[model samples]
Target chain A: MLAFLLDPAALSGPADGASDMHPTRQRLISVATRLFQQRGYHAIGLAEILALSETPKGSLYHHFPGGKPELAEACVTRIAESSLAAIDRLSGSGLDMIGFLRRLAEVTAAWLQRTDWLDGSLLAVIGQEQGGVNGPLSEAVRIAYQRIEMRLARWLMAEGVAVARARDMAATIIAAQEGALVLARSRHDAAPVTLVTDMLCTMVDRG
Target chain B: MLAFLLDPAALSGPADGASDMHPTRQRLISVATRLFQQRGYHAIGLAEILALSETPKGSLYHHFPGGKPELAEACVTRIAESSLAAIDRLSGSGLDMIGFLRRLAEVTAAWLQRTDWLDGSLLAVIGQEQGGVNGPLSEAVRIAYQRIEMRLARWLMAEGVAVARARDMAATIIAAQEGALVLARSRHDAAPVTLVTDMLCTMVDRG
Candidate 1:
């Protein structure tokens, strides 16, 4: 296996060493994630991913035995971890939970701006594509959402909201963020991201 | 050109009559909308559309000179008009604005229950796909959203909310629905849909 470079965010997990990965596998994953993010999943091909990664066919399969599906799973897992870490880091700050949420809002707005509104979260793309089909990718999508939802729920609980209300609010918070991204992307303005986040934060705080 | 069997929901628009349509064009639009909504825009092929619609290849080109893009535009427009009518009808029931919104929540829930959550409002799909892309599709998406936002703003104004707040709330409410649908689709549950609409309705009513 090529050496997998540990993402700073993923370092908290058990795989502390860069020992396990082949360099080509790491390159393949990074390239796949960006391609999948820009175009819908089915719209892309293995050759494109391999070419983009500059890895040979044998090396590509050498790491991901399951081919495209395996690579996709790895990409989803990596992206999910990175995203969760960012959210956790923001929310884990010493500030109050509401303040943490506000900070998250800012990060999300910045993300929309930085990507020029083209980057819908990877889990989201998978969620939309596999929404109808029942498969591992779909499961991966669910697990990713659950991770975010659980984290948000915990933050809301820390803020003293009821468990049920907190879960609902977390879901609403997510919806607002996702929808705001859609709007910002379409409008080419990050203004909606900020506005939606503020309104949701207000709703959470008022409760 | 096959005759369009008018759906009351579809026909409420300003250009409702089959008298106005070239029969083949009407059939193509109706067939394309169903296929696109059921199986996504890219997954369905032109041959399948022509076969199912019983329209010849020549007629398809005659109607949609720009081919898939043109057909896609027609589908978006038809669905957009149909959606606006549905929203209008639901919001126009003798119920006040709040009541109308509440019923809309229920109606939407019922609608989701009927389909396998497949035929999402087309505007929402276009909104996501064309959000950051500058093109005719993007403009059409923006205009469709503007229409929804305007109707929602009117409802909020009737509820005695201040104008600016109403507009802000209108945008947020729309965002919530779009976002909530994404969430609901991800989780394969109507709960998020109900939760978002309920929470927003309460938020609006309290204000």
Candidate 2:
């Protein structure tokens, strides 16, 4: 069942020191992100991350002093930032609110298909897995979600929606999308996300 | 970090053979369901469940000979049944769709508060956790969501929503609520769900 880890391109990266994006440190985060996303925090071990990222334990400790949780936090933060960037890109793509929502849903569907349908957001998976169970990680997860909600609400306000409605819509959009992704991932299908987007666009039009 | 396992109400059951509800087998399911809901499938071990439920190895083996996955599947099924029953009860209540959603959100919020906000569903936590990782469990989760969606759609259709629209609204309501729960757990707060409920009620009204 763990056969999903047998990625052919997993080891194709440089010998740990050649990444122009972030060197060995970034490599570890990228691989760990995917591993944690594919499996989960408990199911994954640090040794597996080292092996997959082609990094040694010494270097791993050097980068992430708190070990697995620390590395996982970095992964969560990374996912949060990248997700916000995606939101900003779509928000500013000149699409109307409905069009933006459709584009966002399509992008998420494409991502689910691209990742072998693993998942769309690491924070979301981790948040659900760790929430109320892991205190410190849950705090970080909460902050990440809060930031996304804030940005989403702000974007809606810019679109001429009222402040309160914008905030409510933002909350609704995030919850709907995340929940739809969970349903979609279960069936290995992306139809749920698109359907939710259609429903949300109708809501937006009414607003 | 694992101190959350220390539930005061955990061991109050009538010692093994005294449960009028389901005997030792039912007790085992109740305990395991909470454990799996708080932590994902991989994070929770059989030893913990047995220890907490006060069940011996032989009894556990007698009921769930297939071990962890089997027990987890049972938990998912129980949650699905209980959840659908709630949906049915709420649908049958004299409340309109708006009042129905408000009551649903309030009930979920109270559940979160009651559980110290651990989470409200084992299937959602496990679905997000095991979706792309574990094939059998994912299929089970998919079936449960489909059942809930079907029932929800039927209820809305009874309430005068068009067939196709009822289906979309049901999908939207499920996604929004599940996603809202994840957010709520992160902060040990229920506001996200309530806020999403408000937004959903409006969509529901417009429909």
Candidate 3:
């Protein structure tokens, strides 16, 4: 669980005005998304996000319109786009399932270190805290997960894994990756993420 | 990533007044632990905890003089003690590492179902939300994870795994389990958890 890639990459979704969005609006969403990822929805306030982004409160209302949840929805959209792009970028390359996962481990570890462990998967933080309760956010979270899983499953199926097995493998991989991020952040170490990938790759090699 | 088992099982630790504590206090801790596990530390409030537990405000203050965080610390303590006991109980049985992991998956899945997907790892929810920011809470979360990792590593070492490899495997398993809980809860399905354990067990069995 890391922040979304800003490049947006070559994926199959609308860009959502991210490139052309107002600078102030983009700053608010970026700041809010990171804060929400770190401290969660209930803990952080809009004032802090506004002050951190150096944007006035009126512009926030003007851009987000629906305030916090609305902004969070944008965060979800941005995250989903960025994350899917990341997956696409990795999978489309010459990486198999294990290679794709190993690369993910490296990227996530670097991200954690670069951010000083302050950032994690926004969808994960939101999903765990507000998973079933936060309506639109929760729905987005579910869809994002499903999309990521489907992509991973497709990768597995390409390797001749049965459809059911591929789906299960994808689900398990995602769970471990997300869970590893939490553990790594909590322990202030990235070994957990790398370890899981290593173990999985080793197992696959053995088979 | 589930609530603490109440029986406390056999292990070493101060009982911490759980058994003979005032019913009101016990109820407060129990209610607070479950709520914190579900909605996270910041999302749920003292008033809501009190209302859910049906305890008077006076009783709440009398038990936890330090208030919300204090109660949360108690919840953490209770959970830590409970989780350690769960580990001890599982490992001390005749189950090997694979069986131990398999049993854990089943229990976690059932816990998810029994709780209607609301409950998950308390330390995980709190750790992600307040991991680095909340001082005492963060410290407790780190220790809890370390203790669990050590226990799992010991189990692996018992299987003749080398020290470093066992440690990585332990760390990876914990990360996956915790992450699986988040995914399972988000999707309101326990298959993610069961799927992870099954994959790990199959890999182990194959080896």
- Give the top-scoring candidate (lDDT): 3
User: How well is each residue in A110-182 modelled by candidate 1, as lDDT tens digits?
Assistant: 6666667665556655566665567888788777777778877887788789999888888887776776665
Residues A1-207, candidate 3, lDDT per residue (tens digit)? Answer: 433333212112353436777778777877887788878888899889989989988998998789898998888777776766666667678787677777778877877787777776777888878845848878888888888788777877887788987787778778888888898889899888887787667645543
Q: Report model 2's TM-score to 2 decimal places.
A: 0.86
Clashes of each: 11, 0, 2
- Sort all candidates by lDDT, best to worst: 3, 2, 1
Candidate 3, A201: how far from true, in Å? 1.5
TM-score for the A-chain in each candidate structure: 0.84, 0.87, 0.86
> DockQ for each of the predicted structures, in order?
0.45, 0.59, 0.69
Better of 2 and 3 by lDDT: 3
Model 3 over residues B1-207: C-alpha lDDT tens digits?
423233222112344435666778778888887788778889897889989989989989998898888898878877776776677767778888788888887778777787677777888888888845748888888888888778767877887788987787778778878888888888898888887786667645543
DockQ of 2: 0.59
Q: Which candidate, 1 or 2, would have the higher lDDT against the true structure?
A: 2
In the range B99-139, model 2's lDDT, one tens digit per residue, is: 98887787778777887877545667788677577667777
Show the lowest summed lDDT stretch of 10 residues, model 1 chain A.
Answer: A1-10
Q: What CAPRI class is candidate 3?
A: medium
Candidate 1 has an lDDT of 0.66
**Which residue pairs in model 3 clash with each other?**
A1-A121, A179-B179
